[model samples]
Target chain A: MEIVRPTLLLDKETCLRNIARMAEKAKAKNLDFCPHFKTHQSAIIGEWFREFGISAITVSSVQMAQYFARNGWTDITIALPVNILEIDQINQLASGINLNLLVENKESLVFLDKFIKFQAGIYIEIDTGYNRTGVAAHKTNLVDGLLEIVKNNKLLDFKGFLSHTGHTYQASSRHDIFNHHFDALLKMRSLKNRYKKDWPNLKLSLGDTPSASICDNFDGIDELRPGNFIFYDLMQYKLGTCKFEDIALRLVCPVIARHASRNEVIIYGGAIHTSKDSIINIDGKELYGQVIINQNGQKILLDERNYLHKLSQEHGIIKVTYKDFNSFKVGDLVEIVPVHSCLTANLMGSYLTSDGEYIPTIRQA
Target chain B: MEIVRPTLLLDKETCLRNIARMAEKAKAKNLDFCPHFKTHQSAIIGEWFREFGISAITVSSVQMAQYFARNGWTDITIALPVNILEIDQINQLASGINLNLLVENKESLVFLDKFIKFQAGIYIEIDTGYNRTGVAAHKTNLVDGLLEIVKNNKLLDFKGFLSHTGHTYQASSRHDIFNHHFDALLKMRSLKNRYKKDWPNLKLSLGDTPSASICDNFDGIDELRPGNFIFYDLMQYKLGTCKFEDIALRLVCPVIARHASRNEVIIYGGAIHTSKDSIINIDGKELYGQVIINQNGQKILLDERNYLHKLSQEHGIIKVTYKDFNSFKVGDLVEIVPVHSCLTANLMGSYLTSDGEYIPTIRQA
Candidate 1:
């Protein structure tokens, strides 16, 4: 395919393999593989999950849930804390599909209980040290208040406790990741143990790509909703969650100019295409992306010395070594493995498969 | 008028005032105001510039140039370095509009010389300490080679040196901003003096909001092309380039959840909505955005104690002060002044004016 601008290229085979591995792992452990559609956000890509007998999916917002629902996804869970203002949309979806909503506070439940008319499964989002959102796992009194509101509301069905071990992403080492995951598992299990007596068949849902990719001990967790695993990025690779080859998405950008004086190459890709998500490199500076040159029918991954160093609105400045700098010229397409695939994918809206098919995402939908 | 999701709120009066102030500044100095449209990529907003007699405009890509061209903008400069791969589009745009393109190297001119079919203006992008993209001002031999090619090519009109003093954004003080701007002025002046004998009507264009907003001196420059000043952000505010009141855009996001124990609020806005641009706060941590509580129909700017601290794919964690924390609850819409307006504006694709009208940007177009 002739890529003139910054286009996200998805390797279908690699993406399928990633799905198969995660799906197989979940099946072996007998855990529900309700992978988060927020990562791919594409209906066509969501259909790929069906090959592994996966019928349920997890989205991040009401709009995403609506998007997937329209695409024939019946059983879906919105993992984001319920925005009571979107109760109208929630009711619309809940009336048709088996929509599950997440609630972390009694206020959300109070609001949802008052406004929601259709049956919707409710998951009390339990905090397992992520501290971004969710009720603390230890706060059973608060959980009781929320569950009481759920019990009082005929439309709301208490599903179980849900936690995203997002703290695993900040792990300094694999040992740290395991420790964070294990601690979260214990907290989630404690909540399940306390509540499962009254709500038997309550399912524990845990998410975050780092924990799901590395941890095998899902003893009490019933479902996994790891999103970024489907399109593993440089951030995941840095965290040792996935191998470099497992990453399926690449941003193909055209080289516009080369500055040999500073050993830099300017590409059409920038914050607009890559979304400015960065990781610290060995030099202790921000590394925007890992650069790979696609030239002469060969893809050559440049060394750590040659990486995307800076980004503006519509310009990506790649700091390259002298040896690699001369290899690049204007009009060549260079593939960038973004620091965060989810954000990059969201920015691009659609992806061009390696075979040259336009796969529209939730943004386009 | 009712916003349930993360919406970019544009205050039309504030935005128009910003445009008038910049236009007046350019007029007072007798400098041509060809403001960069990369920030507010809306054709409707672009029309606002016409009131101030801004007929010429600057864009960062060929697609953006084409978008503006279709919207009736005749004199357009694609401020990005010429991508030889898009010669076909360049030829098409040049044939219809008074198109101008930036070229930093002889190779681009050589390629343009070979393929360009219609009359096009060429600006040799000069590196005036901003080593992102541009030829060094002192490199007269290299400049001569580029000019030689432009002189030989009948279609490529030589439009003198253009420098984006973007390094002014990194200035620690207003003095530093002046120093950076003055240094660029000196360098650009040197280039103009050396080349004016050959090309009498050559023009020097300067860009970047920091330099344009604060620096009063534009002695040697012929045109100014600042974009971000149109939507002055927290970054511009922090740099002492613009007042907080000058910021015209805000990401109005609904509060989904609030945790009192840690004094944190989770907004529906995330990396997807805000684009992850951050400014280091006084606390010496990454501050994603400054929060303004829009409760009870009154706007209250929360102190530095409360700020957006973290962002994930679909979540934004705002660290709030204990005193202000109680004022927030589920479903309250909070306004966040973004660190960088351009990226946030690009991600949002469209804006809802304070009067409740949808303003579509280039992303939406």
Candidate 2:
């Protein structure tokens, strides 16, 4: 099969191995392994997880939950804090599957109670360190207030406490990641204990790629959800979450134009194919991704010290240095390890297997 | 009409006005107007240009040209250099339309001659300051050698020179933009004069958002092509290419969560919705875009001091300043003018017109 230029190449063997490894980790810990569906977003990829005896899943949005529901996934936890605006969609989702919702505020609880008629598990999101979302972890009153609403309202089911330690992405070393995971688990355990007297069967859910990938100690946590582990990226590699060899997805882009004077090569892959996510390399330089040999599959350390400096609508400018300058020519295909593989895979909209097979993907509304 | 959160909004009136204004400028200069389709990438939007009397159009890829061809656009130019890998697609395109191709080297010319059967107009891309692509403007011998290939080849029609002065994006002021335009045109005119002695009726096509948006002078050029004018973004606004009122596209996002302590608002729109392109403000601080009134339809300064700093898959972190912090609350929708509107629009798949209307977009393979 003739492979098209600027296509995503997925190693099926590597991908399946990664899935099994994650599932094995969850099984050994005797924890509920709700692998985040946001990473692979494909029904076919989801089938691989199902092959490993994974039934329950986690999604970032109500729309994603709907997509997976249509794909025959019976149970799904919409991991994002319940956006009251999507009450109709949530209600629609709940009518079919065992839909679980997340809430970080009182307003969401009020909105859910008014709109939703069916009983849906509501997980209170605790903000351990990632200030992006969720209520403060130590806010006992906030948790009490949410539980109070649950008691008064018969529509919602209190599903204990949930936290995503997203700050683990900023970890510079393995120790930093382990510490973040340990601290977050302790916080979640404390929150569950605080509410244990009332609920008695409270569950503690912890998530984040770094926390789940590096640390095996999940003694206090009842469930684990790590998404990006399915196809780890350069950022994950830098954070010590996953090694470079473990990355399963790569963008195969053909060199359309080569600028010999400036030591630059223009690839068909752009910001649209590989996302604009960047990571500081071992040399302490910012790079979008590293270029690897298409045939030999060896890493090419290009000069000019830049990975992808500028990206237009359909063009990727790869800045090259002197040592690696003479190696590339026009029409040569190079595989790029995207900085954020999950986002990049989502953006590319399609993927080609290593053996040259096309797998179409549907976008979530 | 209930609107979905995190959608691209296009003002039809502003879009039409911008189109008419560009057409008027091209008419006054006695130049053919061929708007680049990369900005919109919509068949419906292309039809709007056609209604405005646009006969020819420009696209960044052969696939895009094919897309417009299927939509009944005949006169199309693939703006980027002819990729040898895509020669078959270009050949298929040439069979349908008056396809104009861009080329920078002898190798591409040689490779294209093998499969190209029909008469295809070839534009010798001249590098004028922007060292991204094209042959150096000062290289007469190189130009002569390339023209010789056109003279020897019967399938290729030498349609003179074309240039995209992308350096205008970095202009400090309106004068700087004008100077960049002036310098680019002067160089193109000199090359045209030098080549006209041998091949008269040589067409000079100069394109770029800055030149097309601001420059009134187009004395020697036969055609003007600019794509980004259809969706004027914050970058264009900062470059003085277009006014804030002229920015036709905006990402309509719903406020999902808010943090009172940090004075930050988390929105459903993320890096996927708004590409990571950013611009510096008046105070020398970087900002993505301004946040506008959600329901009031009034323009509000987004407390430019802060930023939409970190973004997850479906979440955006809008750092709220002390001034605007308390003004915002959970569940309030906001409009963010993307730093680069074209990239944002492309990533979004298409636009969701205000009033909850869905506009389908054409995607290139």
Candidate 3:
């Protein structure tokens, strides 16, 4: 609690603010606030969302769902395509709670249908252009077959189609993200209308932080599952989705060594702690993270030219200004706004709240 | 102990073989084998090296040094430049056993001299073209100043210059790696020769997997500190340093979804499990990791076409050949040879040994 090495510092106020804002946004849009628990990966953090009346949750892995379920979460949707290998655990999970799964193919559907003993909700993943995963929106034949298989299964409850417009992270401006969101809305709306006759209460799910944060048009969606909004990072800040203040998590690294000639301060943090997500800055330099100063218990994001330039396994080099180099001595704790908070949170495995309370990772539990 | 999800699988036999081979190399070369424990970051793995008659060890963090020290590693080197803030821990650690610290500045040396209650071995980190950290190799003035400060300090034992020939990773072939190693060898030998008259027992410390693995030319180096060789990754294999069989670690991920048309399989492992270290392949495409098949208990590296192309937080997209894709189902466990095993190992936090024993991480211990 005395803040010694590269510790992930979480501000509860900022974090709760972020969660409340997103939950309110969903409420205003008349959409289901199914917050994703993959980012924080903590049952304690899950309780924060629960405080805002969020019950339906999204997670990336079955192991995660089990972790949350063991901690008393009931309504869970694994946003990732179901790992049919984990059917035993899935079946066990679904038997006791409202378990939702994602599937993109017939083999997965058939396997679940044959093996599942309990009622399960199924969401067909639609690929709107991310090309990462999901069936193509234009593939009507595939969608129809997928739906047919789900309908045939007595235990499986056809939820709806889920699409994560991940490419919105690549959008150049807020307007660009809005366009991408509109495009996804149109795609999901069309699919929802097409299937409304068959399944009357089909819900279209859209999740992605940039689109959810930048765009206000959530009229056609039934649920919103933006996980990263809980701890918006430098990536979101650069994408214009969140301000510096909204970026809640900061890795506090100690200044280990100083290279005055280079105007650099080596920190006791690296790829292991902050991760290797570097962003190209305006100066054509790759910034692993931005330096921020924790003054009198308040974190002030430094808009200075100083940057966390490089990171090895356990070493981070922060290129600082001459004044900064002279002011900070070896062993001083400098807060860094990580490029991606989700990955950083995962790597750190836990968070040290600013109030000095140690929050255990869901994995730890 | 059935691997439920994204488990870090370590073949202990292969890992032991790797350690033995490196220890044997160091023995034959007449150099002290101080293998960096940063790769495994496990006290159990440290004990594996101890079985090979390894007494001293190298680590990247002070906390890690304490972890290994607590686990019975007496002679330890905190290889990264000393974080002046951890003087208390360093002093406490040094008082118990032989503790070596890296320093590149007079301020750090002065602070250590004034505060350190126990004697400490100091290694001036020399920059050998990596430019990431360390004092530039050509800066004799800086080196002399650093040496003078150490020599002036009564508690500080001035160890020889330590340089990591990291540029060996950038080399195209084994010949190029040899050139980088040879260049570093010359620079370190020159530094040693220059200071040999004053400090006869001063030994040169060199590390980096590519330099240590590719070239057997370790005539001048007094200590070999290569870490990554123990769990050689796709990066090391690509650098022509380690053979495919030498790779000791693999991430076992389950296939969640299958895209038959594009021959892509969505795996339940991603940036969170595998640190995003992508390497450019022969076709000039960025590859996260290579898919390896388990055939009759032997792990076979699929080197031709399959690649872990894209990764989200918990999703890994492996683009594969149609035949290979068809052969595997949604529940098959595929091993991936990570691009950088050090970072990958760091992310996973623990290992499931081939013997089915769960190895606790250094942090856990």
TM-score of each: 0.98, 0.96, 0.95
Q: In model 2, which runs have C-alpha deviations exceeding 4 angstroms?
A: A281-285, A295-306, B282-285, B295-303, B354-356
Worst 10 residues of 2 chain A by lDDT: A295-304
Q: In order, what are the TM-scores of chain A for the candidates?
A: 0.98, 0.95, 0.97
Write the residue-wise lDDT of candidate 1 on B45-109 in tens digits.
99999999999999999999999999999999999999888889999999999999999887888
Task: Output the better candidate (2/3) by lDDT.
Answer: 3
Candidate number achieving the greatest lDDT relative to the actual structure? 1
- The C-alpha stretches of model 3 lying farther than 4 A from their native spots are A294-301, A321-327, B138-141, B294-300, B322-324
**iRMS value of model 1?**
1.0
**Model 1 TM:** 0.98
lDDT of 1 by residue, A160-188 (tens): 98999989988888899999999999999
Local error of candidate 2 at B222, Å?
Answer: 1.8
Q: Identify the superior model by lDDT, candidate 1 or candidate 2.
A: 1
What is the C-alpha local distance difference test score of candidate 1? 0.91
1 or 3: which has the higher DockQ? 1
What is the i-RMS of every prediction? 1.0, 2.0, 1.6
Tell me how many clashing residue pairs each candidate has: 0, 3, 0
Candidate 1 segments exceeding 4 Å error:
none
lDDT of 3 by residue, B1-365 (tens): 88868999999999999988888988999999999999999988888887899999999998889898989999888888788877778889999999998887677788887898988898888887776667888788888887777788788898788988887888888888888888888888888888899889899999998888768787778999999999999888888888988998899998877888788888899998897888997678889999987766786778658999888888999989877887567788898888899888887778999889999786455
